[model samples]
Target chain A: MKKLQLIASMMLGLAAAGSVSADAGKDTYTKVCAVCHAGGIAAAPRYGNAADWGPRIAKGVPTLYQSALKGTPKGMPAKGGNLTLPDASVKAAVDYMVAAAGGAKAAAEPKADAKKEAKAEPKKEAKPEPKKEAAKEAAKEEAPKAAAAPAPAAVAAAPLVQEGASAADVNSFNRLLKPAGKRNLPPPEDGIHDPANDGTHALQPPLAAFGSLPKSFAGNRVNWVEAIGSGKIKPRWDRTDLTAEPIVMDMNVVREVKGSMPDVVYPHKQHTQWLDCSNCHPAIFTPQKGANQISMASILLGEKCGVCHGKVAFPVSECRLCHSKKKDLVKPATAAAR
Target chain B: MRKLLTGLRGGLFVGLVLALAAVLFVDIQDAQAEYGDVVINNHSDAATMRPVIFPHWFHRVRFACKVCHADLGFKFKAGGNDINMVKIIDGQFCGACHNGEVAWSVENCNLCHSAKPGTPTQVHESTIQKLAQPSGASQKK
Candidate 1:
């Protein structure tokens, strides 16, 4: 008897946790949806405004679902750019939103009408003209059913699998997720964002450019990159130059100079964007290095670094760029010769 | 008929001799030359010849190969460029860099292999300057 009571209480707790709408949803609405919907930009219905929602709610839950899912001229982003939320969750959010706007009567009226329609459907088989009405209602019910199930399954599977996979694999998986091999829409296309739903929009990865460079300048600095990663780079109030943090990158060029030897943790990316790919590929480094003989002797003879650095790109004349730690190795004669 | 056979045999012999000369000429012309002042008998061989001689001054100005070679394709190894010379000529091996827009026109031979010493090489300084400049919202382009 005690075990049965414990099981009943656990089930109740789980149900409460599932249904208890978070203030995160409200916060998300303020941040993302409030942008257009609050001001009625592109005729988007206002967030807390009842007049805009009353007519929409009267059209019933499925119509509102269609407007949110398929999108409307209201300029509301598909799923409010929160692709992480399940379709059912979005519907619940819609329900919460509409109820908040004094449209509870319109929201509650749908189930009563659905019950009435359900009762009247059986009666329609006895009557001739009513069959058309029953069929149309049945089709309406089927549409939401078709749109709901697959989306939740897809949303649930996409994030966890991607959390660990390489960026290339995630891109390939995204392609596979598309229907019929058609171009898939990005997160914003579905009027949904995952972070908007769970107060964790902080975690959704931005669609960065190749090589993890931010596609936009909004997050230009390395500190901003950490900010986008999840304010986890530092405590909420702390500030530090993350790029200036000491980086000891050990790279080994395969058999060119020394196979499997540590390459100085040269501040590479800092200097890379400074030059072109041709600077290295098939050049200082061979298309294949072990195939060619690139020796330190060559670099010293004004051929590699000696060729231009005394003149350009902060010259190898400044040895500290490469040998930032081993300052003693920088010979004064070498600097004088340059 | 005897005279005709003699002429035919002579013509065949001439063709064989010419073919042999042509092969020798190609082998010498396609041989790898010493790079910089570095000498490496251990690394040098006939097979490694014509693999490619990548020019540094021409490339450093335009791109960082780390983006392409390390980020895009895996690092290369020896004997990797067992490629058709014609394909490379048409835009494959060194052709990747030799593409006219990025660096020297592949059509010019001595541009890459100029034997002259102490000739100051030109690097496109503006390209480096442009890359170093922090790109704003325009980073997408």
Candidate 2:
């Protein structure tokens, strides 16, 4: 049975593609159907000519659908070569044709009334009051500007360095600043100094990284230079150009790491403004060198400093950035003692 | 000796011609770079610089890379070599971003087409006035 159906469909498909049934209703009818059907052109049947279509009307709806699906014995091309038309369209055209052929029973069935009955039968009335209540609740929920107010508070609390702070203060400054302008590139306009003006709560920059701002300087923040490169600190992403040409940092060391020559100061805030702290903190130093088992051997072998310095940032080839002093003179008297 | 002299003269003539060509080519290239995408000459005139420098870094911070590149569909490279002021004012390439919300609206011609580089503020005010004006002299006709 399935095989027979398949054969029948295939036959219909072939007939549809061909140019038979030119005058008989189906086939590629829409493009040309209106011309003749709207008016009896060249003795063609008028669209609503039930008297003329009475004989064809005796045939069933499915048969007419098939006829439209597969062209008649005339020169009409099957399916109109308008592959976009679905079987449903063909069925509607068949219905129209059948209705034209005096199949008034199918046409006058009052489909709209039936559809209305099917959709309208539930007659819902009980739950509307609850929905209205829900709407009112939603409006009430939306009334307060509470959510919007917190953003300014959040911005105020974000890590931004107040002026005249230590290296620690600089770190908190960056953290606070990071959240304030999540999407934009920093240092933000108004120059990362003023607090955001949304009125959620009183705002202040994050607390300083060091214990307290030195008494010598009451309110001045150290320049970005002192924060990162000072005290033997080495910054990260030195090679990565954030906005323009690579910056060759000049740092003055304030402290020395043990067993390590004086810590070549790394510029913290300047580099932080360019890149995030995660770019260096763990992989590069791990808060402190010995905490992560970092060694000069690993560094020289392209592990840490070797990653950028020799290749992109500035080659360790200019040795002074790290080893600050020249070799001591070997005096002749000292040589004799040796 | 005659052949050598002839060769030297031929080489000198070729060298001089090539040298002149190279100089002209370099100047032309430099001029192209100087005027690269300057559609608005008014701003250029008011500012000390002939072309108002629309540096990428200056704008990229506020707008996302994708906002101009993807949403507006600007090509990654600069100096399309064919971008025109009329097309911009009518809201084709750069106008998509420069439309009032993002940058200065390009509807006013002198805002960008100004050839003077004097006071940028004065030029900006004049451009705003021009934008506010009703289509005037031509309307009388």
lDDT of each: 0.36, 0.34
Docking quality of model 1: it rates as incorrect
DockQ for model 1? 0.01
Among these predictions, the greatest lDDT belongs to 1
Q: What TM-score would candidate 1 get against the native?
A: 0.28
What's candidate 1's i-RMS value? 29.9
What does candidate 1's lDDT look like per residue over A105-128, in tens digits?
665444334322433221211111
Q: Could you give candidate 2's per-residue lDDT for residues A1-338 as a string of tens digits?
A: 53344334434433342222223335435564655556766454567778756655544333344344434443322332232355444444554555556665643232212223222211111111111222222122111111112222222322211111122123432221111112111111111111132210121222212223221111112222343334322323212223433234344323344543545555553444334444455656576534555445555444565433322233343445566543334466676777
Regions more than 4 Å wrong, model 1: A1-19, A22-28, A69-74, A85-89, A116-338, B1-141
Per-candidate chain B TM: 0.33, 0.39
Q: After best superposition, candidate 1 residue A188: deviation in angstroms?
A: 15
List, in order, the clash count of every candidate structure: 24, 50
Q: DockQ for the candidate 2 complex? A: 0.01
lDDT of 2 by residue, B1-141 (tens): 345435533543343344334333322221111101112333233334333324222332233333444345454332333355676777777676577864567654333332222212111111111233111111110
